[model samples]
Target chain A: MTLLITVFAAVTVTIIWYKNAPDTSMQLGTLSLMFWGASIMWFVDAVVGYMEEGASFFMQDAAEMLNDLYLGLSVVALGLIIWLVILMIKDPHRVIRSLITGTNRQ
Target chain B: MACFLVPASEAVITTVAEKIIRSKEKNDDSNNASSVPKVRFSDKLGWLNKMLWGGSALLAFEHIWHGEVIPVFPFLTAVQNGETGEMLAEMGTAGVGMAVLVTLIWGGMLAASHVIENRKVDISSEEAGQ
Candidate 1:
């Protein structure tokens, strides 16, 4: 199931990039790398979850704690997505500059 | 829930407006004949917003790894003391929510302040140049 999702995410990203981004080697490479990195991180997270899956009652509680932590992080991520959209709309020029220069807003 | 986006949105708009106002102030103060220095306050606020956004993204990435996309390990079957789990869960959930709320407000404040300081910078530059 996890593998399937990972593949789906990667393919989706690829499709989006192919359709939206300019046909540049750098863009393609960057997209591929992003998917690969995300996949690897997801894999590690799943492993930890599975390992704790069959533990004792106390262990299960610990796993649950970890799971909650994960959920909280998701909220933060959603916040960021909102932030990014806001930034793009409110300051498109600045956003573009930041992206091109790789220098954070100072 | 729907209204939550308003404060943050307003902050960004106001900040940008302030920047424009400040720039205009500098331009009008032709007697000063000085280029406006980038305002420190606004710059700092920009940094704060970036940090908040970046932090949030990292948190989300962590969530995705754990929740929906990947579970590298087997499921945790061990159940700890039910009472303790319940307490910890409550605390964690609350803590996360609070952290996000605080950060959002902080970002808004920073943005608003930046706009004001940007104006100040414009005025000061004009004065100095004169």
Candidate 2:
């Protein structure tokens, strides 16, 4: 379930990153890469688990699936927050820098 | 239960490797006008580090949420529950599997980027000739 969610996020973000390729300042590529990486990680986890638990690997409890889904979403949200921080620190558009400069001038 | 630790530890190694590589490549990026620019090894290593660290972090969080890991000693709950054998088996399988797969994926990504970089160089050369 977590793997599926991450794969979904990875695909969605990859598309957005591609569309926004003209603007590299936002660093959406980093977010996209992180999601893709996580998806691959979870893919392996799923495979290993299937080997261990056989067909029952997919037969997780509803409550357990819900918890995993929340975890997946939380990971996505955390990634977004980290990316936002990077964007602010990068100030690729110089937004923060200009703001500070303008305030200093005033 | 302890699967996330494997990738997390791998992340630490790669992080240190990136630092060393970065220091070594501090002044090697100067390309002549006719030269085709190439990606830095350090930057590629950085990308790998990011992947491992990001995935491991989220996996750890997920494990914690499931109560598979705890804050106290013998941090994995499976250890405390006398499921040591099962936990070790999981670490051997899921932990190693994730680490290997992520590295393989990063390799593919690196290859794709290298091919694109070369293609860009070829196009520019063709345009220059014209």
Candidate 3:
């Protein structure tokens, strides 16, 4: 379920990035890449889990599913946090620069 | 062999670090004359990023509220307590719904930006003609 959520997010972001490829900035690309990376990681995790648990894996109880959901959301949140840090570092539009120079409003 | 590998790796690391530092300095100089427009606090992309962060915070809070993150690996079957099946169903629904909503917003933004760019181009061409 966590894998599914991340995959959906990744696909959605990728489609948006694709449609606006020429004009879109690196931030969007960064977002897409992060989600896609998480999805791939979760995919491997799911595969390993299934291999170990076999058919029982599909029959997860409600609590386990809920836990997976939380974990999935955490991963999504972590990815966004990383992206935020990247945006701060890049400061593409010079917002940070302006702030530092105290000439932001001009 | 070990000594050779270690020094070779150190040299590679040092070269990469120097390159990164040089590029960062160059970027700092060029940033003053960057072509990209300055971002305002009310920028649409900025709003979107904020919204994403807000959602993430809410999810984190939810995880904490349910105690799904403390004792063990939440991704695996670590917790022994079980939840109602209905609650599980609702969570699944909500998760998918949130994903869909976010995607729709991003798509809308993309379309809006494209239209805005085209209009700007048209206006510029008109000014040039005049």
Indicate which candidate wins on TM-score. 2
Best by lDDT: 2
Residue-wise C-alpha lDDT for candidate 3, range B52-77, written one tens digit per residue: 44344434443454555454644312
Interface RMSD of each: 10.3, 1.3, 11.8
Model 3, residue B116: distance off in Å is 29
Please give the fraction of native interface contacts (Cα pairs under 8 Å between A and B) kept by each candidate: 0.00, 0.53, 0.00
Q: Is candidate 1 or candidate 2 better by TM-score?
A: 2
Across residues B1-57, which tens digit of lDDT does each residue of candidate 1 receive? Answer: 011122234335545865776676666666565455444444444433343333333
Off by over 4 Å in 2: A96-106, B30-34, B125-130
C-alpha DockQ of every model: 0.04, 0.64, 0.05
Output the better candidate (1/3) by TM-score: 3
How do all the candidates rank in terms of TM-score, highest first? 2, 3, 1
| Tens digits of per-residue lDDT for model 1, A21-51 | 6643324323333333334333433444465
Report the lDDT tens digits of candidate 3 across residue range A3-104.
788788778877988898875555777687557534543354455457768989789899989887877777667766777888888987888889998885
lDDT of 2 by residue, A1-106 (tens): 7888888888898899899887877888778777776787788888876877899999989898888888888888877887788889998877788898875422
In candidate 2, position A51 carries an lDDT of 79
Candidate 2 per-residue C-alpha lDDT over B7-123 given as tens digits, one digit per residue, 9 for 90 to 100: 889999999999988877775544333367777888898788878887887777778877898899988889899999988888888888888888887898799999999899999
